[model samples]
Target chain A: MQKIELEISFFGAFRKYERTGPLRLTLAAGAGMAAVKAAIAEALDPAASDLLKVSALADAQQVLSSAHVFDTSAQLVLLPPVSGG
Target chain B: MSQSPDTRSIHVCVRETHLSLEKASAFVDAGENGAALLFVGRVRNHNLNKPVSGVSYDAFAPLAETVMGEICVEAQAQFGPDLRLYIEHFKGYLPIGGISVIIAVGSPHRAPAYEASRYLIEELKKRVPVWKKEHYLSGDSEWLDGTSLVENP
Candidate 1:
């Protein structure tokens, strides 16, 4: 199994949930997006996975949906829809 | 307030207690416009058949400003050289009949100014992160989902 570094941002109501560092998880190279999200949930809180509407980005652009697969060196960020005015 | 020749447009805030037509007009003049269209959105005393007293608004400032800037960029792209626009929205408590939002657009002609002004206000109401807390005269208050109310969420 290889390790992947993920950067996560929590906004709006979720900001109150985790004020500190992003959850870092190590997964196999061929892991699916769902599996990676589940790993993050396990590291954070199980309820977080349910509350979060996640969007993954490759590089600084291009929004990736859940159907995409993850590679070992891929950079990922998890952000929930910010509920604001 | 000072003027800059390089800045043909401006955005400013007026206290709820004191709104000035002069300052707002200056922004339009600064843009060297032949026509200016301004939209003032006020708080009504009643809403949806219910009595209303006041309202409060809150926002994530950085994100809100970024979003507003994006709107301006989009307006520029859509309207091209014919339009210059300014938008101002009040946060915190606003009493009945108080102006809550202001949008001003300037153009060489009234058509683009009017069209852009309408577009700016509609898009801002749809996209901006300024949430309102509606207060009723019956002693109840509720936080309104701004985007949701505009059918953009």
Candidate 2:
């Protein structure tokens, strides 16, 4: 078994956490989006979990689903509900 | 028969700069197109009775632009290929009355122009990867609620 480090960025209401830059998390290799979400929840306070539950994970190109598996370190982001007009 | 919008005829961007209605109108302008509709979204002085000084916009620029392009393409495909569109969303902080977003549509007729303009704005609100934080005069700020993009399991 091995572990990988990921830099997960935040957006929208989550920007308050961004002041510290992206949240760094370590996950087991071959992890998927669900595992990533769980790791994020574990890293932050419980209050953030509600928002995290609804937020979507994305790579540079598109929104990723829970089924998306990661085999290596990645730069990702958390996109909360969008409010742009 | 209508086809997808020509990539050249569609202009979409997400930038941390002022959004210009003039640019939007100019991009969608065409001699053959008789109708040009412009929808500008501005930062107002208040929201939900809270006096607002301004607003700060944050966006995932790459995906926001992509989503906007897709909306414009879809509008043209439904309205007609002759439809030309310009869509932009502003990022960064802005004082009250600053333009936040603009959607311009040029079409051969008013019907399609109106429809396309409405379609673009509505879809942009729902799909774009952008967020708004309102700054209140009371020294408080909050992010407004919005349509979610997350997929439910």
Candidate 3:
């Protein structure tokens, strides 16, 4: 099985719970978004574990649907609700 | 605000540069449209009794743009095809009175222009994937929940 690299990031209040800066994770190419999201939750400091249930996910160009598969390059981000006007 | 030749609407963006009303309005110019309504949002000097010094925003750019575009498209549809839309947001640091967001709508009448502009702004605030950290004059900073529309968990 081939592995795909996804550059992951946390935004807003999630930063305080982040273990480190932007992370690049390699996962099996066939992984589902749920699996990827689980991995992200596992990577965060324990205090941030709850955010996984609500945080939105997106790539560099668009929001990723929940059923997305890991078949392409991923600039993954965990987004909280936005407040821009 | 950017007036990309390919994207005249300039409907979505997240950047570090200051927002420009001129650029936003120009992007949505409808030559024969009777009204071009432009709304500029600025960081307020006070909030919750705290004197705010400035604000810094961060965004999940790709998703932010995508949602912003959708809001613009939806507003156009609601208002009418003749109406054009433009939306832009500035990230990084912006002091009190600094422009944070811009929404411009060009429409055939003042009613639709005003209506669409309000919808675009409210929807933008509710949906765009951008967050702001407020810096207080007391030298303390906190991330005020930007998503007032949703009860944050």
Model 2 accuracy (lDDT, Cα): 0.87
Q: State the lDDT of candidate 1 residue by residue for A1-85, as single tens digits.
A: 6766566544333445555754456677777767876776677665665444342333323335556677755544443432222
Query: Given the true complex, what DockQ would model 3 score?
Result: 0.49
> Model 2: chain B TM-score vs. truth?
0.94
Those runs of model 2 whose alpha carbons end farther than 4 Å from true positions after fitting are B1-5
- Over the true interface residues, superposed, what is the Cα RMSD of model 2? 1.3
lDDT of 1 by residue, B87-124 (tens): 76776687888777777877887788877777777777
Question: What value of lDDT does candidate 1 attain over all alpha carbons?
Answer: 0.59
Provide TM-scores for the models: 0.61, 0.93, 0.84
Q: How should the candidates be ordered by lDDT, best one leading?
A: 2, 3, 1
Better of 1 and 2 by DockQ: 2
Give the alpha carbon lDDT tens digit for every residue of A53-81 in model 3. 66677766666677678887677777876
Point out where model 1 deviates above 4 Å. A1-85, B1-20, B30-32, B148-153
lDDT per residue (tens digit) for residues B1-153 in model 3:
322222555467777887888877787777788899889999999989999999988877767787788777777667786777888888889989999998888888899999998998888888788888999989999876655222333
Best by TM-score: 2
Assess the local accuracy of residue B67 in candidate 2 as a C-alpha lDDT between 0 and 100: 81
| Model 2 CA lDDT for position A64 | 81
